[model samples]
Target chain A: MTFQLIVFYSFAAWLIFSALMVITSKNSVKAALFLVLTFASAAAIWLLLEAEFLALSLIVVYVGAVMVLLLFVVMMLDIDYAALRQGFVNKLPIAIVTSLAFFGLLYYFITHGEFGPQNYANPAPKGADYSNIKELGRILYTDYFIAFETAAVILLVAIIAAIALTFRGRKHRKAQVISKQLEANKKNRLKIVSMEASIEETENSGEQEPSTAEEKS
Target chain B: MTSSVNFSIISAEIFLLVALCVIMIVDLFQRDKERKLTFLLTQLSLVSLFVMGAQDLGLERQVGYSEHWIKDQFSTVLKLAIYLGTFVALLYARPFIRERNLMRGEYYLLTLFSVLGMMIMVSANSLLVVYLGLELLSLSLYALVALQRDSNIASESAVKYFVMGGLASGFLLYGISLVYGMTGTIIISEIASYLSANQANLMIQFGLVFIVVGIAFKFGAAPFHMWLPDIYHGSPSSITAYISSVPKIAAFGMAFRILESSFGEADIHWTPMIMICAMLSIVLGNIVALVQTNLKRMLSYSAIAHIGYFLLGLSIGNDEAYSASMFYIIVYALMTIAGFGIIIFMSSENKDYQQISDLRGMGRFHPWYALMFTLIMVSMAGIPPFIGFWPKLEIFRLLIADGQVLAAVVAIAFSVIGLVYYLKVVKEMFFVDCEDSPKVSNSRSLKIALSINCMLLLVFGLMPDSIYQYCISAFASLN
Candidate 1:
């Protein structure tokens, strides 16, 4: 009846439709795209619920960053879409049974007894400056501070560990050993000789005298 | 803005943040040339955290930051256990990390961060705090599971964990919002008070069920435990040890805070649900674990069963049950750490030592390590004269006291079933012989740390009264 209710229902319906499509779509890429739609519509619902920060984050993080990456990866991979669908017939019975059971349970839960509609006395106006982002930030920095830090540390560790694990050393090849290189010295390669020149001159003079005597004979 | 800051309430966070920054700096400048220095710094930080947690042991329950968080004896004890457990895990991880050339600043930093998250989860007094802590733990784990990036198995496990973990978080947040809408409050204590005054509200009950499902999933209870085996088997053995031991303590702490602190008034609704989950987890965990060939995967399922036992204590929904659960978590953590430590010791860079056959001839080749591992396995199986026995005894005693004989019997039967799989590990270690012996090598530090860890299990098994008394006092404060 109200404009707000109309908008809410529209987004909610779209969300449900998209989610269903995500499950039922035969093509993997179509299913992924449907999931993106579901995420967007859910963000709209979050906005209606006055969780603006969460709604924006859902769009920015899930749809913008994560989904885009997923789309790229999915597109790049050489997957057999038809092969995946082959099991659909075999799984149909189980799927239908599960859906029916879930629906029945949900119906029982909702209709078996009346959960009195919660009424707050003098409820605040729908948009009475409720900034979810600000409150979330405050809560996170104060009460949930330890958890926030821990998350950062965990991420850091994962990054480091990933790099370390991947950075394998080259397997046993005959590369020059550092110890062998360091052990090499000038004494091992070169020898300074002072008597070598005098011995060479004496050998040359004896050779010349022998040749001269031979020629005179 | 300044009024929002509560130094005492956020002291644990501050300590961890400072420690993380200091470790980061030390890691950057300290150079890998002096690896011992980095190790010393890490150990020092962890020990100081343990001491800080110990100091808060006798403190009265105090709410800070507008009742968004509370610190009490139960949290303090659990935090102490987690810190100590993580410290021991880190000590065990060090040798393995070095051997695999995986030693880096991030590993220690991430571990410290994960511990910090556990501390927050233990002390959380609000759903928002709970979610924050849970996400912190979950995100860290996603990365930690994928820490060994070169291993395809690790990457696959990480992807599975990430997807499932995101879904679980979404469930938790939605449940929180639903409860918030029904109660008009996000603070857990307020929600409990509101629910007490307004019982039989179907919406509130529905929200509570969703929350419990989320919690159960986080604990890797049945029907939501698909990720545990893959993650455990895929991660490095040391990380698996860390994952199996420390997070369970955090999970228990979270369950206590949510089930008891917030939903105490909704006992009629939640208790039955928890009982069903507990029974399911026990039956499913034990039955499925019987067929697992991978040691890590088997241990993962066994951990699920242990959670069921812990839940049995929780489902009793009394002070005695709470203490019993706490006791169970502590002992379970120790036994799991010791068991996984042996695996880490046996694992090499190329080999994971995850399969039962990998441990064959361990008794003949490395008799002492095998003996210690056997002791750990027997204790894990809940055999007598080990620390694991006390938690089981406590849980059964509480169950009997609470007049739940059938559930207690079920728990005991599952415990026996659990022992079968654990004994398979022992069987492989001792009875089975290998034609080619695989040598087991460990550093002196690792040997010393593991000796202390296993020795403490025996010591505590013999003398559980001291810890039991402490748990009693903690629960008394809770009441």
Candidate 2:
């Protein structure tokens, strides 16, 4: 029990420290990395609470997909960091006050509120045969089916939105028209000569047959 | 609370989803010249959705899909409004898009998807479902706002919208998490019952505050309204027509669903914050609009003020007040669509006529169009004998009924100030004249559509009893 408490406290401390670093980091990329660390620590805490599904998802989804996306955006956009920092001093007092108030309230609740070991006893350990993913799947497919489908639809919309934003059509650019090329038929490319054989013009001009026919006519 | 999910209850959503996919596929084969076919298909889908929603009306409200989805008369009304509003907006968008060479299939497809998102939002019963729907809607909107890719302003607006929208959604998710932790439920109805059975906690109140901030941002209420004006001005006016009207109705539905349904018992905790936002929006929206020359930006501010009035009704927190707010949003949407529709009609080719001076001498040349514009402006100004007057009157009536005399007076005073800018639009059309006569678009269909839209405002103004009653009944059936 003491060991468990030590692990929980350590993870919680790490989570808070990384979260603070996520905000206070000077570089945007560093901030994003710190955010990932914060998420990882939070997942560790969730695992300790027996929320295996949430812990795995917190690592897989946030650290895997969302953080990567954030990193891409941060790298893509050339942000003027100097301009961002310029207002920090001017806004410092209000920011500090608001954040302190928020922290104080949170601390008060955690320390004084009716939230303690009595309300949140350690969850029973699962049997060796137990599977958290299977439980999640069961609930998701049955009770939360609509929610799951809605989430899928949101993902689809995000994909569509990304494509729409990035897709550019340049009409003037030179590209192979394979379909148009393949659609050229014999009637369009070749015509049968129904006139008499203009042998003299053919020998002298070695020119196109259509031109020879027109000249002969 | 049933374990088995009923598929028939959400038939409209299913149909919409299938139709959107089919439209996207069909649009792939259509060339630029044949884009009208895509437009017609989209419109047909919208009309069918409206019919489906209409047929579902007056049915018993049912919660299905393990209570994460709901089908109620209130959602039905809001969904129907969204469908009808989109239909009108797309009809107005057609000529403008064609002239600007923006008749891409993606536009229609994205719009249909966004509408689907809105429908989901209106019917969502769980906070998670609500977040998903809101994200879908906003993601599509961010792309739509940046559709004019070459324009720097459009790109800038899209970026701003994305960042602000992301921040708001974060706040909302945090609030949802806190609420879930407090009550051990994510379903709105269950949350309501839970809160009613217990005393409100500080954690829940904090969650409610964040939720209120998120809602205010979505509604473009003051202090959180920085994104609204720029987005309105930067987007193509066709998209502006959609963004300015349909989404507001959807937002109101979302607010009602979350606040009145889930947090109804905790109203006292959230009311003061909402009241402050309402007051600030009204005071700032009208006062800032007075100095704007860009017609779209002015209307954007006017939208903020209108939300202020809508929030006024919400703050009162009664059946009468909820209905009044509903009626106001519907009325406001109608007037706004017509207002932006005229702007769309005036735009020829890529040259958008959105400035106040663009309407100069238009009254002399196109008397009928000008008259339509006049009616819309007067309605927006909250003048008598127009539809806008009724909703405002209803709000004020409810305010007075609830013994909020100070709120009523303050709202009335701001609205009077709002009248000056609305009249300025009319004055630009009539009193001012330019030497060069701007050519009026000869699209008879758009003219006819705008005329009908404007006439409905006046007609409904004259006979608001039925509509008002409909609204009252819709809210009365809410759990």
Q: Which candidate is the best by lDDT?
A: 2
CAPRI verdict (incorrect, acceptable, medium, high) for model 2: acceptable
What's the DockQ for every one of the candidates? Answer: 0.15, 0.36
**Best candidate (score: TM-score):** 2
Q: Candidate 1: how close is chain B to the reference, as a TM-score?
A: 0.96
Give the Å error, residue A91, model 2.
18
True contacts kept of 1: 0.26
Candidate 1 Cα misplacement greater than 4 A, ranges:
A1-217, B1-4, B433-436
DockQ (0 to 1) for model 1: 0.15
Question: Per-residue CA lDDT of candidate 2, range B345-420, in tens?
Answer: 8888757788888899878888888899999999998998999999999899988988989989999999999999
- Model 2 iRMS (Å) reads 2.3
Give the alpha carbon lDDT tens digit for every residue of B1-479 in model 1: 44645678668778777877787778878646436776788788889888877888889888777677788898888888888888899898887877664576667877777787787788888887787787777766776777666678878887888898888788778888888877888788998899778874777777888888888888888778888888777778889898888998898888888888888988988998888888998999898899999877788888888888888888999998888888888888888998889878777766667787788998888888788888888888888898889888889998989899998898898889888898998898889868777656558888888888888878888888867877878899976
What is the two-chain DockQ of model 2?
0.36
